[model samples]
Target: MSDRITIKFNAAQFLTSAPTLKHCPPDTGAEVAFAGRSNAGKSSAINTLTQQKKLARTSKTPGRTQLINFFTLGEEQTRLVDLPGYGFAKVPLEQKLEWQKHLAKYLEERKSLKGLVLVSDIRHPLQEFDRMMIQWAEDSQMPLHILLTKADKLKKGPAKNTMLDVKRALKDFQGEASVQTFSALKKEGLDQLKSRLTEWLTPDEADQAIEELIDQDSE
Candidate 1:
């Protein structure tokens, strides 16, 4: 849809946290996930996207979100996941390995995971962990929407170039992966983010909403 769908961010509420796949909530409905490096502003992006401050618990400390936290959008079936950040050097080796294992299993095996919103810092772009995530999405044939967060840190020209560069890098990927610049601090790209989430989490509803809008325009 060309027009952005209005999202009720306050509708989002904390669901549950699962340390491992076995402990996750039931795999019954469509859910989109957010993943990124520890210092990638993942939590800021989530809070900004949902229009709810402290929804995902933004922290100055990296690797603070060690669990896979779930947030539902009014409905229990529709969900948004905050995955533990990867590539944190300060975290213990054993714990880092454990997080990796859990993340890999969930990405590869979660039936309810419709798509992923891979958040990356625009300044740093794609790191090693981000490439691994891209590989996983490619192998699974899952749709991926990349968010170049902290775009405000860069000038307009550099931000645009970064988005283009990332898109080019992902061109060789087998699965669908889209890239866009985002600035949680400036509230940029919220509309686009919400629109993508709508398409992924509630495709039918999105279509119906588009149809309704078109009808209104005609009338």
Candidate 2:
């Protein structure tokens, strides 16, 4: 985390009012999400990102995270939501649709959602479902930062190539985007993510920093 940034942590189980497009944890602050396929290391990535081992529960079995779990940063100044993983699971199609519905409601209606921290296995980066989630974030006009998980399982060259491929995938999507290789097992890339997260959590300061950058460019 940035030395200059103040951080707060809280959590809640917010429900999405079905067919009505309402989501819980209704506080106006920047929200980011960690999304991916079940068993794609989403919970592990989240736990690593927050520096909290159990912040997001991890299960070897798929379909464990059925509801939206919210983790607050900066005391609601920002939220890091753990959205249930989608695709390649044993859940029934109708239930999957509801999950999609629930997620859609939050993405479209949650004014606080500022960014999405998409997690994907490096072995199969930008899988079909991953692309769809990225599309949702783009359509919602939220920034996206992809976490290429399981980096330690690959050779360094392959890992670099995977990162390159993931970046290319985002080119088809619009809005601000970035990619960072991560290994929850090794806890690599935590500091980079923390710094970027701090900026995302603090929009006013981020905006000021951007303005200063623009001024410097002009000068």
Candidate 3:
């Protein structure tokens, strides 16, 4: 079995915000991106995952995150990206289109992107924009993990049913796809999220050994 590195998500720090793909940091190392519609609890889930109250900046107003925000983990090269929330942002049509263009460019061309975490409200899983994202991921053959946020709002049975329904819906997706219920308020399903991220972000055993050796030499 291959060894895995434990990621320290609490150590995550704000890296930078890029308005477009061209302004993003160098395309090196692995990164996972989080995308969701406005008011989908995406920021809250990120904050919960990082064990920070305001890591991703939660606001009562929907669509406060306008740029592609990047956060660095314990490893400088490893990163978590927050893509701009789509649909329901109170921006002009031209601005929304511009944002979509940049978002598409990043998703299509970012070489360092290892996977995408698509957040949705558990009560309203797979909205119009959500399905579009899933389709895009399928077309690009990108690994997609769906987080049905706000699961605490529903009863246990409903939550499980919603998750199961989502899983069934995605069975036809040709690419790697998965769905899980999550609740930032309750920190429910946090461990599962971390496990998925670790699987995507952790380097292989050989790479880890090399990195360990480099660190030891530096020390």
Candidate 4:
């Protein structure tokens, strides 16, 4: 375990939303995308992570968010993308296919995409589309983090079992990824989640400082 210093992430503010990759903001910096099945609490997780009540739009209806939403974290270059949810969209199949195509284009070709943050309901994890998303990350050799969202719905033991099961299933994955249980409502695993993100998003200077701290402790 790294006894690293706490690295604070700046409050994320809404940057923009685009229906297509071409309409997105310039791709010049690191970005981590949040993806999940429809109505899987992706928006709620984003809101909770940013400590804002309404940073990302939340709706009871599935597939309410039709566009790709971007939020900048302190810096203009570092971003968190809230991608349109897959599966169970009430829209026509033709429209759903369009969303899927756009999503695939962004995931496959975006130059600045650094990682993926996959959100899934703990009760129904690793669905077909979820598996596809994981495969995309693996194909790109990018790091992926799976958030088993709505963990509060399950009992503690069952949640742990689910997380373990997911992790075990990921052993066959070809690239780097991790799985964890999370609950935006109960604020469970928030610190650990943020710490994992900090490991990915920490700037060079902050990383150097952490290294120095580690060196001093060793001395």
Candidate 5:
């Protein structure tokens, strides 16, 4: 296998926000999406990953991220998607359903989606909505990386155990799955998360060489 490319997450910039899959940018590039329940630190993780203080807005009120937001790396074809937060009880049932419908359509139909990052609070991991996401990824044969956010809130021992427990719980998923502890405040597990995203979004050396050759020929 060819060597993998390194991605500069810090350079990520807002691309666009789409209310539904139809509004999304043309589906022709590799993108990994982040999903989690409202106030579960999903936005924090995104900001931390990109080393940007405000790449994704962190709201005190839950369910504020009603749209699917997209961020592009140096290349438009490499992207990181911030999906709408789920399981916000304050939202009306109809609105919640609408968000879920759009989310499902994007996950099920987006050809450029390469993987998923499911963020959950380390203190309360694997809630109902999180399990639903895991099942969806398994059914779709999509690779998933679970981020146990807020690791700084717990003692080291408990945090480690939580990571292990989450891994054991997902042993039956049958698709590519991994778990790690993270703390946006502490900047913990940032490298691991970056590595996973890079693996998903970066094209290998062979593909890069071919693209370069094609560009040269076109010129």
Candidate 6:
């Protein structure tokens, strides 16, 4: 596979509001969205997965990414969505409500959204808000995957055990959802997360993927 299978995030268009999201092109390309609490290392994880510096900007400031960001994954024409982080610190209620409205509408209605990559803190697996979001994704039938960020902060045994605890908590949701320990700082789990993301690329873009499997089988 091409290293550019994930490309530079060439554009970060800031739509004024969620209602304007309808104006986006309705192309059939696969879309993998990333969402987590503000400052939960979403941008860093994206950068690590794509192996591109600054594809998504990391920030200590809560709620720096206040709009939906889009990027193409090179020649195969995959779409990656960087959603605005929810639950920012010290934000006004009205602004939070506005972001929530936009994000909820997009998740519930986007036809081309093939999957969602939900990032969360490894130490606290399922906060109530995260659980509610998982239920929503489950109801929407979207293929879901969890990126347990900050894995490097914990010891290996504790990290693996925490992952299992998370998986056990997800048994009810549908689709092939799985959890992977990740740390953009440590560069841990980047390759594994990228491999999981490969499953989200549009079926058409996955042709050589099938052929490669066949070649392996033939050998």
For each candidate, what TM-score against the reference? 0.88, 0.83, 0.91, 0.87, 0.92, 0.81
Q: Write the per-residue lDDT of candidate 5 for residues 152-181, one digit (tens) a residue.
A: 999999999999999999989998999999
Residue 24 CA displacement from its true place in model 3, Å: 0.5
Off by over 4 Å in 1: 1-7, 205-219
Residue-level lDDT of model 4, residues 1-219, one tens digit each, is 365434334478889999999999998766788999887889889888888988888887788888999988887778889999957877888998898889988998887787789999999999998998998888878789999999989999999999999999999898888999999999898988887776666546765687689889999
Off by over 4 Å in 5: 205-219
- Encode model 1's per-residue lDDT on 73-135: one tens digit a residue: 888888899999856748778888888889989999998898999999999988998998899
Better of 1 and 5 by TM-score: 5
What is the Å distance of residue 89 in model 1 from its true position? 4.3
Residue-level lDDT for 172 in candidate 6: 79
Worst 10 residues of 5 by lDDT: 1-10
lDDT by candidate, in order shown:
0.87, 0.77, 0.91, 0.85, 0.91, 0.76
Segments of candidate 4 deviating more than 4 angstroms: 1-10, 203-219
Q: In model 6, where do residues sit more than 4 Å from their true spots?
A: 1-20, 204-219
Badly placed stretches (over 4 Å) of model 2 are 1-4, 8-23, 205-219
Collision pairs in model 2: 8-74, 8-75
- Per-residue lDDT tens digits for candidate 2, residues 1-219, read 344455443233232322323546675667777789887899888777666787788887787667777766646556788888865778789988878887877887787777788888999888887888888888898888898899999989999998998787677777999999999999898878876776777667676687689889999
Model 5 TM-score on a 0 to 1 scale: 0.92
Candidate 2 lDDT (Cα, whole model)? 0.77
Error of 4 at 47 (Å): 0.6
Q: Flag the better candidate by lDDT, 3 or 6.
A: 3
